[model samples]
Target chain A: MQRSPDDLTLSGDEQIAGEADRPFARSLPWLLLVGGLVGFAAAFTLTVEKIALLRDPDYVPTCSINPILSCGSVMRTPQAEVFGFPNPLIGVAAFAALAAIGAAMLAGARPRPWFWAGLQAGVTFGVVFVHWLIWQSLYVIGALCPYCMVVWVVTILLFWYVTLVNLGRTRAGRLLAEYHAVALTAWFLLIIGLITVRFWDYWSSLI
Target chain B: MAFKSPQNTTASGARAKIDAARAQDRRRAARKRNMTIVASLVAAFAVIVAVFLAVDPGSGPDGDTLAAGESRYVRSDSHRLTTAADGKVTLVEFLDFECEACRGMYPLVESLRKEYEGRVTFVVRYFPLPGHFNAERAARAVEAAAQQDKFEIMYQRMYQTQTEWGEKRTPADEYFRGLAQGLGMDMAAWQKAYEDPATLARVKKDVADGQALGVQGTPTFYLNGTLVQVQMQDDLKKAIDAALAG
Candidate 1:
């Protein structure tokens, strides 16, 4: 029943193919956990800043400068508190859930199928809000809130990581394995470059 | 006849093994279905997020109508006209004549005035910031234009040609006269009002009113008494609706 060395070589080739096919099978959990944790921290920080602003009118944080770099200028505007409530309340709730998911993942708990679906949904929401806030800051408000920019940058990175992790989990990994890492890194760099260009004026004006 | 036996046996064996191919097809179909479902879910979630962010949510009353005990205008000086028109919403704009942002906001105010004619009352108040050299003189010129019933025309002209008169190189009076001539105003009357000390006092009063209301910059607005911090059309409409409702 002993196979020849040529037969053994063929079997080894098949094993390697199988391993290559499931490339991200081991790393999916870790990716989601870390991405979610970073996302949650960024969102939580923004929520705290927004709450402090809401609690006190005269309490202008150090961010509010002249017409262009003012946090109060944009926050006092209608765009900041869409839905008649400060939009940061949504951030607080959603990011808290993300952080809990991250904790569960770190504790070696396998998320149910529904959890993956919901994470995808939440990340999509976060990405859309980030883009909208950027538009408001660039075009409408004509000002940039420095803390808000931090939230935006972190949201983009987390969204990209979550998307890659989700693709790696499902059967789609077979298709996405070709350039996942390269594409994700490229996207991250592009986003950072864009945000830098958008705030170029503020950067130049700094003393 | 001897060759037929082996060929027929092989053909029958292949027919018997066709079940495995059918099973493989079933597995492929299941995987396809799962992929489709996941793709649809992701797409649906994206659409929902886009819609939520796109919705404007309307404006709510979050701040005071005006900071406590603040006067609408600094003083009832010669230049200040207090007109009362019942049941119409009023829009009061405090603008610096030489400010770039104020210049940008000029046409929007004009368009709103025209669009909501008779339903809205529009008032212009001058708040020339001290930093800009020509802003005070330009405010005086605009006040003179008001005396000639050419306030709107000259206001538009100021923004339209802001760089020429406001920035440098030309005196304020000369620039105002050129703008007046361009707008077909009577030159003599325009000059008389431009030189009047009373007009300067009025411009100063406008600045005081703006400062009293915590107006830190040019192009500040008051819609029926609430200080409007943002200039979005939809938000402005919502604030107007609330004012009407009250």
Candidate 2:
């Protein structure tokens, strides 16, 4: 196995130590594949809905179940088209690329560092954009689209795992990698907490 | 083999080194396995707790199907035009101050407020329509006035003088600031609250609540959790009267 210069920085005696303790590293491609496909499906669904909305002005989307969960309301807003085109179009392309990359990686393709760096950048953008959308959905838009939420969850997981993989050469990174599941669980809990708190009235009334 | 040392010594030394490395690997793997098990158990326990709390089996809605929809009608912070001590009926109005339709309904709403008095709670919500040039600014001004115990005066002032600044392309912020001054509000404090992002957020919160209640236009009224269809001016009165009757 060809080791990079970063791998040599570890203790001399434990030359191959970091490589062996990487079961989490092995699961990266699986997360990418699954997350990417999930995100892709959501984005594609949103795109189709967007097209339908354009075709007929009064088209109520299938995902718009209630006022709080209304995609129809969100789709009509300018924020849905930040680039003068529907945001889901970007999602469709990016998620499709992610799925292809995951497939390549799963097929034992060892790409270069720059390639990983690029993927990291893409996911970083995706995660940041997803969070912005979350803020908009909860705060500004005052609504949530069910499909958009599916995309949010997958994007968060993909970003977390991709970041961990990119930094796996560092000691701190390896330590974090070991506690990956715990950290991920905590992150998800935090988001769930935010959603619960933000829509406390709506949620409480259901009981 | 290439070191040219005694073969047995070299072989034994290599074997010991391999054994030590394997032991370290086993220990590390075991620790990770244990940690993962503990973490998983904790996570599973948390999920179960959340599910239990969410279900709350015995205390669920009691067959009141409209409970969820009813919750959206009024929030604790919603402005009370009139509050009754034992009010069984709630009248929520999502309005844009600069909206002509809302202006048209203002007198009727005022009369209703007077007639209902202590029998119902008249709740006002800010829902500035995007098409209205000064609707949000007007709401912020009203909210800022509200902070100073002058909500009614400023609300009255907006409707009374809405024609002076309504539907112009230019922002009516200066006009609202002047109105704030005219209302005997402390200028420094009023200005501070007016410009505060939190004030805008507060107004937006109402707008958000309105949106969640499926309010797509100004002058939308909810009479006792039921959306009232106001085809004519009399419909609002009829709805309120019917709610009061029940």
Q: Could you tally the backbone clashes for each prediction? A: 0, 0
User: What lDDT does each candidate get?
Assistant: 0.63, 0.79
Name model 2 segments beyond 4 Å from true.
Answer: A1-23, B1-246
RMSD of each: 20.9, 10.0
User: What local lDDT does model 2 show for residue B91?
Assistant: 91
> What digit string (tens of lDDT, one per residue) describes model 1 on residues A28-86?
45654665566566556656767787686545556766434567666777898878887
Q: What's model 1's overall lDDT? A: 0.63
Cα displacement (angstroms), candidate 2, residue B194, comes to 24
Q: What is the lDDT of residue A114 in candidate 2?
A: 77
Best by the lDDT measure: 2
- Native contacts retained by candidate 2: 0.01
Tens digits of per-residue lDDT for model 2, B1-246:
122334587776776677667756854986687678658866786786578656643222111233333355776667899997787889999999999989999999999899889988999999999898789889999999999999999999999999999989777878999999998899888987775545766787677667877898989999888889999879988887787788
Which 10 successive residues of model 1 chain B have the least lDDT summed? B56-65
